[model samples]
Target: MTDTTVRSTGRLRGVLDRIAEARRGDSSESLAAVFLLIATLLALLWANSPWGWTYEAFWHTHISFTVGGTGIDLDLQHWVNDGLMALFFFVIGLEVKRELAIGELRDRSQAMVPLTAAIAGLALPAVLFLLLNPSGPEASAWGVVISTDTAFLLGALAVIGPGKAERLRIFLLTLAVADDVGALAVIALVYTDELHWIPLVVAILGLAAVWQLRRLRVWRGGGYLVVSLITWVALHESGVHATLAGVLIALLLPVYPPKRREVEWAAELTKRFRQSPNPEYARTARLGLDRAVSVNERLMRLYQPYTAFIIVPLFALANAGVALTGETLLAAATSPLTWGIVLGLVVGKFLGITGSTALLRRKLPPGLTMSQVAGGAALSGIGFTISLFIVDLALTDDEALADQARIGVLVASVLAALLGAVVFKVAPAPEGPSMELLRPVDPRRDHVRGPVDAPLTIVEYADFECPFCGKATGSMRQVREHFGDRLRYVFRHFPLDEYHPDARQAAEFAEAAAEQGRFWEAHDHLFAHADALDRDGLDAHAAALGLDVERLEEDLRDGDTANRVADDDIDARTSDLPGTPTFFLGVTGQTPTRLEGPHDAATLIAMLERMATAASPEAPRS
Candidate 1:
């Protein structure tokens, strides 16, 4: 390659890497929200521009295909709605599956609060919409008002500064997922047309084939995709919405990790690959790694970004281009359809979610206050993407009604976001210390990075395999640089074993490296190569750090190193650590303030400076 071409390729690779990294963090939701908003604005501008006729003409253009004497025909807009949106729904199905299997929905006791709130949120909005437009074609559009858009809601929460009220964000996330389930149910049950038996039977048979494939442990993506597309086509021919096919396939896919024996076999193969260094062993090791995770998680990691950034944005551009002329705006404002949707989303969601939570307060989780619930409820009103989706389905034959519903959704979402931001801004921070450092720091036993006598001590509970944890490593290093000797940094293990399969062994490897006085080296190396951390990769890291590979392997084989990592995990659980890269900062005896998520370097430094000031002997205790 030429030098100039090489530089251009390098720059392109750099950009792609940055995009991938960003997609792995909390910022991915924000980026998705930005793209959605930009697409919406572009659609509006295009519709209102002098060339607006082209906008309508282009989307109305028909595309048709035929295969084996069967033909399919659809306009550009219908293709976006029925096809690209299926991928969007597929991602939602993956999220719902993950939550049910391991995330917030796993613990029914903890999940009840949001689950109940979501139920109320879904019902009351439809009730309000129905009351306004009872027994009309527009009444069926009630589903548009019932869901909470996860991307827009989360992006709004980020703007409102969740801070100590981080639990509020969690509540909203769970509620939104449940809301999505409800919306999908509505689409399947109410929006579907009369059934066609033959194709429906064929679809059922295809699903049965999928279940058989699962039973046979078929993990190949291509095989599943082909079967799923057949099922989708059958469903479409059966008069059911084709998009539900994605959800059906997703729910049936296995989410459980490989069995213990299989994981052990993979580990053994990885070890052999390390010893032999041949292509055959290498391929076997790679397959072993792939088998260790469920197909659900693998598919999610592969397709989530495509759904979030590409598919949804395309959906918005296709659907949100309603002309905003004075007569159209006036008609929308005066129509009962528009008012019903606005009131249903903005008023009904807030009242239903907050009131239901209040009524069930005695039975729900205790950490959430009424004010926090109110803030969350207000934010839940930002129903944009799925609402527009339902508008397309519910008012398919009436262009005027569809346009009005779209206008109402756009307007209500903006108002709800602003209102929620104000509420969160004015609400009181949670009572008690902002965060408590439940585990005391031990200089002798813990991996320490700075002076022991530093005024501010930061203890972080993190997992090596977590992408957010890897990002926080840079922030922690910046904190050390900004504070120099005045900050003592301690690391602890809190691997999310269900999500990151290789994390536990990686933690053990780090502990083993600590035995040879290279804990930080191993720590940096593990996070820098998070995607490649297997048994052999751990050994390679140890060898590169000048540690005795044999001794490291011996330490890993021993139970003591694993026990040490387990102790950290126990401490984290006891402290109610919510997620990875949780930090606690304070002096030795004082209560340390806690923070979570992948915070930026400046935020970490500012927080530490405040803690340092408060920890000084000259400062008075509260």
Candidate 2:
């Protein structure tokens, strides 16, 4: 049998592998969702059942310990909330970092709509709650409504059936991250307890230990965990919420190159091998490769299991459980915390997202259409998990008030999920996955490759029928003229069929030209005369570009290009270029920056010159 089959039947058997396989499944989100629903239902059942005594005792049972003449006391629930919840926050921190670095939030324009919507969604609720409960101590927890529960929201979306673009998921995720930033800010500024010196000193020492361990290149995951636990205890005693300790420690932890020097050496070796002249040079690069493999094996052993199967799900189980009762529901409706959260989530989120998005379409760089913005904002109110946690933290002293907030979250979140589902279900489905269009196809193969020799690569996301895209061709040609051999231009379709009916067909015709090595020629011809982009114009453009007439006609009849065009539109959302003619400038060393809309030749040349000079080794002093 093969080693892969042997491993499948290995000594540890299938437990870890099963967990890995489960994670790989798309249904993992659905499972987490089922867990959430079960947890919530169990909380209600436990609260009202004859075994309610057991439930209360289970959560309320206290544990205590003494160290250095100081005593620490906590109930089982507090341990779970203060200790286990910190790990959840750390994972969230990781997700936030990943998104900002390489995921959806990497592009400024891509992030604008969601970021703006999150702000508006947050502001309206807090303002409404504050106005409703002005002087009440319970009103401090208004931040609860500001968060979007990514798992629950996305899971709800998944149930609506397939054919949805990944861009829709990505757009919602960006908004959720924006919501998380808002929530974290609220916790740091508004929810912290008063500082205490003695515990603070201990907390700082714990943090110092973690930093030193990391600096010394320690890759032992257990060491970090032990330090994180100690640090959490110190922070809890130091007057800050213990959960925030996880957030603080996670911020301090380095996620770049691993501690093993061999790993770094292996990466450098890989790069060198890719650039090397001789195949023998690459063949000889084995010892470094072996060392890198060993280091990765060790690192994975230390961290993977604890993070996936334990931390994330345990946080969901503990935090998701909230008592639901008639009393709780009634109190939630009347309480300022409840109404503010409910209205803020339901009314405020939809309005703010839809409104600011509409304004952006008119004034700012470009924005998602009214239909898409409306659908996304409507879904923003699915704030169950995080909202519940904030409510629990916000009214730690008043059990009654906290219960009311939970009721509000349940009602509002359910309403939002239903409404958002209907909106997306009714919204028109585009032709294909949006990613295929954003990432270019290869010339000889069935894929798209970026420019090979140009010093600076300019990738354009365009729709043939888009007037703005039509106007941008001249600007791009001017860039090529100014830079000569220094610039390469790449094209990807981003048709907005919601408003432009002919956009999809126009994109297909361009792809047909691509098959004949006349993509650029057909691109210019079609855009230069967009008003005549119908069947007759497409045929003339094809003939003008010297493409085989019969093949082009046959391909257009098949309509197979729709999926490629649709995929590009979805992928473009992650880059924050929700509209046409969104230009990305990629170079050897510098970061990728997008140039939006139709700029004049002079503006384009100046920007290109700046980018080109920035990539140079010895350019300027000032």
Instruction: Judging by lDDT against the true structure, name the best candidate.
Output: 1
Off-target runs (Cα >4 Å) in candidate 2 are 1-27, 68-71, 257-326, 362-369, 431-622
TM-score of each: 0.69, 0.61
Compared with the true structure, all predictions reach lDDT values of 0.81, 0.66
lDDT of 1 at 377: 92
Cα deviation at 411, candidate 2, in Å, is 1.1
lDDT of 2: 0.66
Q: What C-alpha lDDT, on a 0 to 100 scale, does residue 234 get in candidate 1? A: 93
Clash pairs, candidate 1, are none
Superposed Cα deviation of residue 557, candidate 1 (Å): 21
What's the count of clashing pairs in each model shown?
0, 21
Which whole-number lDDT from 0 to 100 does residue 291 have in model 1? 72
lDDT of 2 by residue, 1-622 (tens): 3333223223222332343343223555666666666666766676667776577678888998877887788887777777777766766665565455434565666578767877887787677666776777667777787788777776776776334335555567777778887887787677886888888899999989978986886654677778877888788877877777766666555543122244345445555565674677576444444343322233333333454456545554555445556766666667777787788788778887778767775532222345666777787888887787788778889878877777788889888988887787787765543332234323443322334555676777788889888788788777777766676777777788677756777888887777677766777788887987654466677777778987776555343454456556656764446577776776655544667554677777777777767678575422
Candidate 1 residues 311-375, lDDT tens each? 88888899899899998899998988999998999999999999999988776433456777898
